[model samples]
Target: MNIASKIFNSHSKEDGDFFLAMTRILGFKPRKLGVYKKAFLHRSVNKRDKKGNPLNYERLEFLGDAMLGTIISKHLYTEVPAGDEGYLTKMRSKIVSRKHLNELGKDLNLIEHVESKIPKAHFGDNIHGNVFEALIGAIYLDRGYTYCEKFIHDRVIVPYVDIEQLEGKVISYKSLVIEWCQKQKYSFEYEVYEDTGNDPVKHFGVKLYINGKVMAKARATSKKKAEEKASKRAFYALQDRISKN
Candidate 1:
């Protein structure tokens, strides 16, 4: 085969593989493969359209996030007729939390499809969720809202969502600890500082103090993560009292 023919054949095989994979994931044939292509396109790839607009999954992630919230909110509203706005919102939040979304993405092995200049091993946990949302956006554009909702219902609601379980799930330990402290009229502080341990990566250490005593200590690559880790440890330590409050 000529060089041009070889290039065409290679592109054809890649497209065929992507189409089959998407079909299996979506449980339906995709009408347009181009939109799905953008779902896995990372900003690091530096692709642009004819109008010089950047083409990446970031915008699709935004759209998919909105879709997930709307669909999940509707489901919560319908299922929990007696639930107040606050209750419904909290349930919805639990269902669509970043941690939950990341789990969904990872379970589907979505990271394998991402096109990026950065190494896959260097990518963060959020990348999984980001591509998952982008795929939802692509579904919406390629098919429509009905298809998008169906995909979410199949992948998220049917397999994972359980109202009773979600009710007890903690989306943010830091928020819970802070709420408990405020309710009990106790002063709480997260003392965070750089603690570059012996590791090559910079780390932050956090001391979570409640009522002037150090409740828990933890460290992570970011101050927010360090604080949350400390808060989680404190929550377990004070679970008896915190649960009562």
Candidate 2:
């Protein structure tokens, strides 16, 4: 398409606002708006292409995840020459951790542009991060690696990443607690059970047992959350012991 045609197409009523929004978020005019739109296309919409294949952001999310990892790995490789493979991998995990990605997505308000049959309020916390990965995948497909790297550097690395702070940041308190327990040779268990108490949603309750004694208890909508919550409480309660050893 000619320049004028491209401009006219982008300004069409159906996608004009979306086009402008993409330009602002991407920091450049997108060559294919469809790819960008696919990033926000939730699977609940049940869209399909001519080939009868499901069309959603899931594929793009996978691609974006790989792309994000590659770019972040390269950055870490260059910046931290002394870090070994394990250290670098852990640092990268900390940077692209789901919690961090969710924060980034929320900051960008990426959910506002989602095309979904489901209500936004019904979406889980990870939805923001999932779409964020989808957006990165779309960027890679539309503009290739260079553009993808630039976007990550601009939005994630330069703005949010701090090497020193990230070094001390705990990605998973549960992991820390488990590692500590294993190293100290203490018997540990997470006893989880259904705990729906007056709440409409069924909850899971977990008790963190160390040395066969209940160290902490917590409840959440999911078993994993409850376990993590209980582990966090256990960590704080036994911080001095854990830290000293």
Clashes of each: 0, 0
Model 2 gets an lDDT of 0.87
State which candidate has the highest TM-score.
Answer: 2
In terms of lDDT, the poorest run of 10 residues in model 1 is 2-11
lDDT of 1: 0.86
State in Å the error of residue 129, model 2: 0.7
Q: Write one digit per residue (lDDT tens) for candidate 2, span 1-245.
A: 85435666757755777776777777777888899989999999999999999999999999999999999999999999999999999999999999999977876778999999999999999998999999999999999999999999988897567686588776667898999899989999999999978653457899999999999999865687688778878988898765788
Model 1 per-residue lDDT tens digits across residues 1-245: 84334534766878877877787778888878889999999999999999999999999999999998999998898999999999999888888888888877876778888999999999999998899999999999999999999999988897567685577766678998999899989999999999976643457899998999999999865677678779878988898665788
Runs off by more than 4 Å, candidate 2: 1-11, 169-245
The whole-model lDDT of each prediction reads 0.86, 0.87
Each prediction's Cα RMSD?
Answer: 11.0, 11.4
